[model samples]
Target chain A: MFEYIVSKYNYWVYIFLMMLGLYGMIGKKNLVKKLIGMNIFQVAIILFYISIGSKVGASIPILTAEDLHGSANPLHYMNPLPHVLMLTAIVVGIATTGVALGIIIMVYNRYKTLAEDEILEIRKKSGV
Target chain B: MKVFALLTVIITGVMLVYGAEDFPKWGDPNQPGSVHVAPRYTQGTYIEAGTPNIVTSVVADYRGYDTMGETTVIFTAGMACILMLRKKKRGEGESNV
Candidate 1:
């Protein structure tokens, strides 16, 4: 039933995006596409963590007098863990992207093509 | 061989992500991870480390060595890429010369 399918929507969406990234990584023939897949895969982890931290009926975690002194409302407390972790992950992702792009540019300069098969052929002919 | 590879992916994916029920509920006091004995190093993180978060404490303190290892891995990969992509000398370029 749709209810059953939607019961755990956050995790399901995360898994779906992760699988999509995996498929793109494996099925693509071009280096750029592979890099895109790698990005997607990394972002998918960020999404997974964010989803796990999410709570129904939760509000953002900025403190106000209504929240602190008044009777605490459990329904509106946001999880602060993933917000912290996602910032770290985004920095790491950017560093990896820079490295990957650098390698790709170098690869293209040497081989003059982005396709893995073409690069391999050129390497074979040139004894590289 | 292809079928085996597919099976492995499917099995592992299912095992690791079994949906909301299997994971420890948020703020669940009885969860194994919550009940597990925390290391002594994690205790000081709440105050002296100036980080209220415990997981960050675990990452930058107790498991600080692991972050260093990840940096090393990245450094090694960068070095390997440079080595692989380096241009050959004129003599090397002219292999049949």
Candidate 2:
């Protein structure tokens, strides 16, 4: 049981971080706070994936001649797939954040307030 | 309203934690992820793309198409931001200029 918990510590930390982000996203009233939560959530997810690519006794994925000479061992290097995919995910996340902030700006310009309740009230009144 | 949001968050967190039980332990060499197509990329990087960094080879060589799309997404996002936020001043109109 101790071994299991120790080995899985990274995942547990990620899960906790994910919960924190989720809470921020859902429980917060401010729109900008929700965006911060979203960024936290993205970073946590990226960290989780990068951790998955780790190996107990491995170097980076750049191959040496020994890696080719002796048996071509996969264990000699950390997994590279997750790193590659997460790079794209990070770029996408930045794009999404930029767009979301832009939308928030437009929303604030029209509604004159960033509070969720006030915006809803204005929307209901203005039939928007 | 806050109470409802908090309740939903707690429920989701519980479900996520429960689901995490089945995931492979950290840094386990034999995990399916490490054994799968990862080996091909690691083993074949030099010959396939002449790149020492496997992440670079796989991202820019094997998956160049996806990267192009991602670049387009960011560009579109920038254009959208400008289009949404920019206001034309009365004196700056094409006819006036």
Candidate 3:
């Protein structure tokens, strides 16, 4: 059981990071902390993808004359799809972080408080 | 809370016992996902994409639309923040602040 779990450790890591990030994102009151938590959540997905794309014995895919000749021993080739996906995911994560931070700044400016409770009270008083 | 935890533990244990039967054999070649669907991409994604990588293809082509939408969600959030936080100028006073 231990060995089996070890072999699939990436999944475990992904789940752990995801849970941690989610907890922080949902449980944290400070806007900045929530943003950081969101980033953590996104990063977990990236890790999941990268791990999925990996093969134990794979080589990086780049064609060369030797590769064409077929003389090179074809042992293992690293999967590329997940890495590609990770790139997009990383970009999206950054965009989300930027937008989330922007919202935090806006919240700060309007309510002069980062606490969600404080903002909610202000909204109530303002009838907004 | 204690009852909830006990319930959860019992349910999880039951699932674990039954799930083993349904779970796909680890690294079974017959798995649909493991099959090499395309020749160029089949052997491995890195060789096919001319990049040193498989995840790339899945992200770039397999599910590119999903990623695009994820980015758009951020854009929408940013716009919402701007609109919500917009304040009237000092001369305009707090009428619309």
TM per candidate comes to: 0.63, 0.90, 0.65
Query: Can you write out model 1's per-residue Cα lDDT over A31-127, one digit (the tens) per residue?
Result: 9998898888888889877666556565554433443333444334445445556756776677677778877887787678999888889889889
Candidate 3: which docking quality band? incorrect
True contacts kept of each: 0.05, 0.69, 0.15
- Where model 2 places Cα greater than 4 Å from the true spot, the runs are A65-72, B89-97
Compose the digit string of candidate 2's lDDT tens values, residues A48-124.
99999999999988777766532457898999999989999998899899999989987787777888888889879
The prediction achieving the highest lDDT against the true structure is 2
List residue ranges in candidate 1 displaced over 4 A.
A68-75, B1-21, B24-97
Docking class of 1: incorrect
Worst 10 residues of 1 chain A by lDDT: A66-75
iRMSD (1 decimal) for each model: 7.0, 3.7, 6.0
DockQ of predicted model 3: 0.21
> Model 2 over residues B3-86: C-alpha lDDT tens digits?
887787788778977887898888889998899799888878877787777889898999999899999998999999887778
User: After superposing candidate 3, which stretches have Cα over 4 Å from the reference?
Assistant: A68-75, A125-128, B1-34, B42-97
How do the candidates rank by DockQ, highest first?
Answer: 2, 3, 1
lDDT for A51 in candidate 1 is: 64
Weakest 10 consecutive residues, lDDT, candidate 3 chain A? A68-77
What is the DockQ (computed on Cα atoms) for candidate 1?
Answer: 0.14
